[model samples]
Target: MDFRGRTVIELGAGTGIVGILAALLGGDVTITDLPMALDQIRENVRRNAAAVAAAAGRARVRALAWGRELSSFPRGYDVVLGADVVYEPRCFPALLATLRHLCGPRSVAFLSCGMRRELGAGRFFDTLLPPHFHVELLRRHDDTDVSLYRLTQQHDDTNVSL
Candidate 1:
């Protein structure tokens, strides 16, 4: 997707790698995680500041605990990214809520997850479907049990199912 001039946000940004890459690719990114991880994410953002600046994009770090305080974050992001964010089953509700709140009518989401049934990761899709979100497989890595999915909120007038 064209990242130029887009405002992006990365949830559960463990090390800020994805956000930094997005910034380098011309997206203004805000990488967020629990407060404990902010320091490291900030460092990663700092390390790539030059590249991000050169691309005319920017990266910043924030602390976001899903569903706890949604009002604190800015809504209507153009893109939302998350890598390995569905590991815990209990966090699914909050995560989905956060996604629903951040993604506007035209926003898209990219979620990368390991397909480990033992971790209850598949439940994410179960939670995602009820919101009338359209989902498609974006990529799969044969060497690993991981896949990425592209998600978008379906229009109210549409009858499509995923």
Candidate 2:
């Protein structure tokens, strides 16, 4: 996607590669993960700092826990992106809550996930989302088993089926 001039946040940034990519794409990025990932996150950020800065915007590393809810996240952003974060059943509720809370006046979300049924997490999101958001199919990359979806603001209707 054209990330130019967008305030973006990435969830479950295990290696920070995606955030670095977004930074390179001209997005101001904040990469967050569970506190346990702090060391790798810092290392990755340090390794890519110059490139990220060269992309012409700020980049930050944040501590975020997926299943736990936060009253307010680091900041409101125009776009939220996550890669390979869908795993486990509890993640759906918390991730959705986080996305719901982080969503701005015109926020957009990009979620990159594998099609592995063993994970069985994407279905939860698919079954759960839609009433509160509008989903658009984005490009599915061939390099990895990852598919990117675009999410935009909409209403929440608990009764809607996935």
Top model by TM-score, which number? 1
Where does model 2 exceed 4 Å of error?
Answer: 67-69, 72-75, 140-145, 155-162
Tens digit of per-residue lDDT, candidate 1, span 7-120: 999999999999999999999899999999999999888888988999898898989999889998878899999999988888888998898889888899999998777977
- What tens-digit string does per-residue lDDT give for candidate 2 at 33-147? 8888878988988888888788785678888886465664744688898887777765688888888778864898888788566767557557766766787768777776677
lDDT of 1: 0.87
TM-score of each: 0.91, 0.83
The residue pairs in collision within model 2 are: 132-155
- For model 1, state the Cα shift of residue 39 in Å: 0.5
Which runs in model 1 stand beyond 4 Å of their true positions? 158-162
- For all candidates in order, the CA lDDT equals 0.87, 0.78
Alpha carbon lDDT at 29, candidate 2: 86
**Candidate 1 C-alpha error for residue 60, in Å:** 1.0
